[model samples]
Target: MPDEVRELAGVPVLVCDPDGPLVATEQDALDLIGAAFLGAQVVAVPANRLPEGFFSLGTRFAGDVMQKFVNYRLRLAVIGDISERLARSPALRALVHESNRADHVWFLPDLDALDARLRAAS
Candidate 1:
């Protein structure tokens, strides 16, 4: 399935397909940002679509990608379970916790969680 835009809680969101291209580099993230520019106020990416390095804080992949979203004034929601990654790194756990507290970046467990968050915000 292709990535498409949908309205969640009255918010225009670009929901990426799980089988879509891997977001392994900054350029790849830029592609998503570009897509969001078309209409979406928020971008929802499946956790599986991201590479392992993205979950590693030391790699700075997550930070850089998230910074792009923030810089572009677009919200990003990483949807899907990251329990194993969080379990292995306290730093990642902290990052996820902090990101979730803000409106710009979110690490949600699923699409339903993203919907709920959007609804709450609305």
Candidate 2:
């Protein structure tokens, strides 16, 4: 399936396919933002769609990609379980925790969680 937009808790979200193109570069992240610009207020990217470097804080790839979304005023929800990765890196765990506490970025376990969050926000 391709990346498509869906309404979750009254918010239009661009839900990316789990098997879609890898978001390993800044340009790739920008493309997603552009796609969401059509109508989505949020972009929900599957964890598998991201490169390994994104989960590694030392690489700073995740930070850069997240900054792009924030710059564009779009909420980003990274969907899928990342417990393994989180266990491997404390910095990443902290990042996820902090991101989830804000409205701009979120690391969710699934679409259901994203729906719940949006519902609460509304």
lDDT of 1 at 121: 88
Which pairs clash in the backbone of model 1? none
Sum up the clashes in candidate 2. 0
lDDT of 2 by residue, 16-81 (tens): 999899998999999999999999999999999999999999999999999999999999999999
lDDT (C-alpha, whole model) for all candidates: 0.95, 0.96
For candidate 1, write residues 51-112 as lDDT tens digits.
99999889999999999999999999999999999999999999999999999999999888
Supply candidate 1's per-residue lDDT for 62.
92
> Considering summed lDDT, which 10 consecutive residues are worst modelled in model 2?
17-26
Worst 10 residues of 1 by lDDT: 54-63
- Residue pairs clashing in model 2 are none
Off by over 4 Å in 2: none
Q: Each model's TM-score?
A: 0.98, 0.98
User: How many residue pairs collide in each prediction?
Assistant: 0, 0
| Clash count, predicted structure 1 | 0
For every candidate, C-alpha RMSD to the true structure in Å: 0.6, 0.5
lDDT at residue 79 of model 2 (Cα atoms):
99
